[model samples]
Target: MLSVRSKAVASALVVFAATPVSFASAGGFGDLGLGNTDWQVGGFVFVAPKYEGAKEYEVRGAPFIAPTGLDNGTSRVQFRGPDDLRFRVLEFSGFEAGPLVGWRFDRDDNDAARLRGLGDVDGGVVAGGYVAYRGGPVTPFVSYHHQVSGDDTGGLIRFGAEARAPLASGIFVLATLGASYADDEYMDAYFSVTPGQSAASVAGLAVYDAEAGIKDVYFGLTTDVPLSDVWTLKLSGRYSRLVGDASDSPIVEDENQFFGGLGLSYRFNID
Candidate 1:
């Protein structure tokens, strides 16, 4: 049971660069509490491509990030994003630091015809930490993540900023802008094609070696419109543009990627 639940948690991490995992109960009050006053847990559905550059889209759904407030009965606070889940434990003034974990889905060659020779890049656990500063309306953050499981799954450094604004009728919006610098192992697994691979590809791919560089620049926006005290409608959209080594790869069919999702969630507050 523990192992299976662990797999679910890991699977949830692949939401954006994608571990946006969730937890629900089969019985009882139906919400898991993380020792915060405003903890929220809910589910949502989204549409996205199977792989980074692929054009085909699939409809999938998962639970949203159930955030726990970080105020330990003090003045400090915590923040969480879809890809990384960690409660800020260290804080000074407007700055905070904490560990981060995420999941990246494997690129299965069978998922697309163009990837016939590339093989599979095993999805793995991304473990790292983050540092951020809360400056009024905007929060700027930088994080380092490394794949700890699977062979040569690679790693990346992500820098981003988030801001929130409220609209009329209690509607709210969260906006994000970020970029990722992938390591050679990450670039190679997804973009590089070896001589042997080039020959094996049915797409007639050329041999290419992808080096470490900026993988992509991304922008995302999420809006929440309250339908009731316990229910909400969430609409999210994201765009990612592959750059540098990732863009020039032979296997890449599209350099501009997009995903959008609309979910109806029932938010339950922890008592």
Candidate 2:
């Protein structure tokens, strides 16, 4: 087992190795990286009062609770902001990279069951960096985000591709597909079954803890409706599947999530 010091050292090495790629592209906010050298930063706040089923999953066999499918409907209301610094690395190829920091305000039941140890995640800060390449239609990116200290105290390694296209009526669409691999500490803390619990007797199934290495595959599509050069309405829908030990856990019961959000994004330094 790697000691804490060893783990920290390994993580640091990974971060340094990947930081350069994020700046390999110079496009705009829509690209994988933050865009060209002209660094720009912004934040967004979103609310989903009507999307009750956004991230909810099914629950069964609760003594008196009537087994009402999904419980604790977490009305999606979250405020997240990212401080991004983009630097132009290659002018000929339009490449850029930078570091970004973000924070979120709510933790849903699944996130609680998976992110928080026992209850809701009040809020937490995530600090990391991204490296990306964008020279044509296909842009590939790799990013590392570690929650400094919060609901999710684990590190995530993600590699993905983004494709952008233009449609009629001045509408633009961006499609993304990505996968991630997470370590045990992050998994067990959120998806593990407790010792006292008897998953076999209760449901005739074996419950795996969060420590099991899990793989997640996700795909998303975002569209931009420009209301002028400075302002655009951005909306996106994303879907994810959790597999491996995390997927087999009793708490999750082989669950999946569909996420959708709408936000207004403003772009500065459009030259």
Candidate 3:
């Protein structure tokens, strides 16, 4: 086990080097000098919502990096996804825990005509932590996020379970299902329509107060096909259905949002 001081120093270093993927882009990798870590790096092209809750879509590209622990007793595997960067600082049994940081792209009225009066929410960093347990074929995880900079969109709590399995020779599928909960500030910043906003709305939107609650449920799937021993074809898609007040907001053109993209990446090893 690393001393508490040592762990904090290492975590801060990772926080400095890696930037979160944000609402528009997705993913990254590991810890430095952390023993024999199997590293994976690749580039990805993905289409995502230009802003959360917007019906519009845009094509985007991001890099991918994931690192796993060797099956050695001294290490444990870490996980990465399209929106956040996390590095395991503690592992015991099949459980690993770590600090997490993700980027949140802001919302601007120009994002969509429907947002003509909602104004702009600044984009900034979010800092949080996560815990996960891996066993059998499924891994369950939970994480919390709080805006550390930019507009005070407050905090979000997200929980989910993911599974990976082989679909065919040299091909595999990974899937994740999750839901998000938001604090009052987070719910209101993008969902609430203030009197001033209502008056300014070109669409004549009504004023609505979006309270803190369960905001949305989401699912994501990834299919990986090996093109060669060192290269792979990665296809991914995610769908999210806004619920609660987030769905009812006058600014929400569509309560359901989708994203899909495919990319080629070189693998470092068997994950």
Candidate 4:
């Protein structure tokens, strides 16, 4: 478990690195000449063939629940877009930040489990702003994510770099690296297991009160291969490790998660 001091220190490093790159390159939007700002909307659909759980007891913290969230085999659809507005916040660099919104539809067992304890924990919602730097082929940025669900609400801190490499034809490869954090509600909803509740494998072990807040620092790899000028094949894989009090919870002290997905996205550059 990472202490609060450690999390703060890590977050500081991320901010220090990502903010400068993002602010320094915020000016590139002017090249598009799409007015000072524009609106972009896009959607993605994906099929997660298998959403397997590594340990029925530790991963979910509840042995009664199934490992995989998708019991009947399901597909997911999500949508995200931003209004890119460029500003000169930093000295010589350009700054672009916008209001963003996203939605995830398609429910799974994990969704049900979380909802069992709350109002309507079904899918996911993301809202936030991103500041990007306009220098070079690789753009660095820092973004704040406010994700809310029926039962869970948390702030996500992302610090990473992205690169665009030109391929044969007009295609390009987009790469990204980032990490995030979650609050206790995020863990209690999905990972907490209570006594008297049913479990598939283990018993007597209940998640009475998590000793720490839920925190996960994840490393992710994603590639966007152009299918056409406006469409691309999006593939992403993320490996996450639990930290903080959540890691010390009696039910899931040793749980780690690796999740991956494949999807197709239609993107529009409004700016």
Candidate 4: residue 56 Cα off by (Å): 8.8
Clashing pairs in 1: 12-19, 13-19, 14-18, 14-19, 15-18
Question: Where is model 1 poorest over a 10-residue stretch in terms of lDDT?
Answer: 68-77
Against the true structure, candidate 2 reaches a TM-score of 0.56
Q: Per-residue lDDT of 97-137 in model 3, one digit per residue for the tens?
A: 88877666677787788888668888577788888887667
Whole-model Cα lDDT of every candidate shown, in order: 0.67, 0.45, 0.66, 0.38
lDDT against true structure, model 1 = 0.67
lDDT of 3: 0.66
Compared with the true structure, model 4 gives a TM-score of 0.49
- Which scores better on TM-score, 2 or 3? 3
The full ranking of all candidates by lDDT, starting with the best, is 1, 3, 2, 4
**TM-score versus the correct structure, for each prediction:** 0.81, 0.56, 0.77, 0.49
Instruction: State model 2's lDDT.
Output: 0.45
- Model 4: per-residue lDDT, tens digit, 37-124? 3222232222221111223221110001001111010111111111111232233444445444443221234422322332233435
Off by over 4 Å in 3: 1-42, 62-82, 266-271
RMSD of 4: 13.3
On TM-score, the stronger of 3 and 4 is 3
Off by over 4 Å in 2: 1-96, 104-123, 196-207, 212-214, 227-232, 263-271
How would you encode candidate 2's per-residue C-alpha lDDT over 183-220 as one tens digit per residue?
A: 76556555554553433233433445566353678787
